[model samples]
Target: MSTVIEIDRLSKSYVVPVRGAGVRASIVSLVKRKTRTVEAVKEISLSVEAGEVVGFLGPNGAGKTTTLKMLSGLLHPTGGTASVLGFEPWKRNNDFLRQITLVMGQRNQLIWDIPVIDSFDRNRVIYRLTREEYRERLDELVELLELGELLSKPVRNLSLGERMKCEVAAALLHHPRILFLDEPTLGLDVSMQRRLRTFVEQYNKRTGATVLLTSHYMADVEALCPRVVVIHHGELLFDGKLADLVRKFSAQKTLVLELEESQEDLSRFGQVVSQEGSRATLRVPKQDTAEVTARILRELKVQDLNVADPPIDEIIDQVFSRGMA
Candidate 1:
């Protein structure tokens, strides 16, 4: 597949003013302001292939939003180059703009007082879609998102999930070749989150559009993105398959055991993560899990035991925590 997005040594920085503490210092600063530079996105480089769903993962203030803004032409880079769909994103050319769409979770593009279908119609006009094409796409989106009941309702009246579906449908009206989704599933209930994920998967499969998504929700990353690029402290930490990340970051597996007695101390067996009455969870080194399990079985009256990988959340927490330390 061809490279749909290319970023080389991309970096973005912001100059924020510094305020002095005392009145005299504040007056001096006002006269000759002191500004500090924050490197929002350090020299980072990555690419996305056409028809690929790539997840961009990071903690807050980790440059995920800054990088997304740069890629979508909302903000220009301080250095380096980026090309999306064979055109420069910063230029914001008409053709390039028409071929791409950005959906931010906390931001709304729909008219607040107007009905959602009215907003969709407005997008049809903005994209200059033909009547036939507009109707066909609208019908498809309405059916796919189950927006028939919500379309006629004003955007303000709709629930968060309802409004999000409308927002996504609005972005897809023009059938853009590239989609930039920033925290698209934020603040949603589990069922709603799953619905949105299913819709995204279906949309990608049907349209074959290239998608770059940045989200804090691990579930979103695991379900939608086979490949992920992890960034921390304005640096690219990992870029590979999700499974590879799990294997690399998680050096140990979790063992949950149900003990026949409630008083046995299992801390000596491994790192005891949690204990409640007769049940206990331990983190054992991957290499010594077998030997440790055998020992536990022989030494204690083990009623039931199960071994599994550590939670992805814990692994990611360890990665960032260790990096900061």
Candidate 2:
């Protein structure tokens, strides 16, 4: 695959005025204003190949949305550079804008009072798609996203999940080759989240579009992205396969053991996470997993045993806690 998105030392910063609380100090600050520079995104470099779905991982205010905005041409960077499909993103070229779509979870692009289909048609017009091309793509999206029933309803009448589905469909009507999804599944219930994930997977497989997604929900990342790039404190910390991230940052391993009896105290071996009937889940240090497993089996009769990495959420928390180490 070819490199569809490339950035070298890409950075974005903001300078905000600072003021004192008291009236005298505030009045003095009018003449001599104090300001601080906040680096939303530091010198971070990354390359994304065509047809790849990459999870852009970071916590709240950790520059995930800022980076996405820069890549989608919504914001100009303070320093460094980025190229998307051979066009500088900050330049906002017509060709570049038509070839990419950004879907933000907390924001809405559709007209609130209009029917969902109207908003989709507006996007079709903006992208200047031929009638036949628009119809074809719209039909595909309606079918895949199951947007048929919700299309005629006004945006105000639809539920949050329904509106989100339409928002995604609207964004894709132009057949953008690059998708920048920032928390696409935010505020969605479990089933709705799953449906959206499935649609994203199918869309990528069918169109071979490149996707960069940022979500707090790990399930979204696990379901759609094979590779992940982690950023924290406006810095790039790790970039590779999701499995490798688990192996690198996870200091503890989980052991699920089905014991012959439920009464045994397993705290001697490891931290017992939960116990129900004969099933117990334990968390042990990664380095002593083997020793803990042996001790558990030798001391207590075990019927079944399985060892796995700590949950992705835990690993991510660990990564944020120990930033840049």
Best by TM-score: 2
Per-model TM-score, in order, reads: 0.95, 0.97
List where candidate 1 sits over 4 angstroms from the true fold: 259-262, 301-303
Taken over the whole model, the C-alpha lDDT of each candidate is 0.93, 0.94
Deviation (Å) of 113 in candidate 2: 1.0
Task: Mark the 10 consecutive residues where model 1 has the least summed lDDT.
Answer: 316-325
What clash count goes with each model?
0, 0
Query: Worst ten-residue run, lDDT, model 2?
Result: 316-325
Off by over 4 Å in 2: none
lDDT of 1: 0.93
Q: Give the TM-score of candidate 1.
A: 0.95
**Tens-digit lDDT string for candidate 2 (207-296):** 999999999999999999999999898888999999999998888999999988898888998899999999999999999999888888
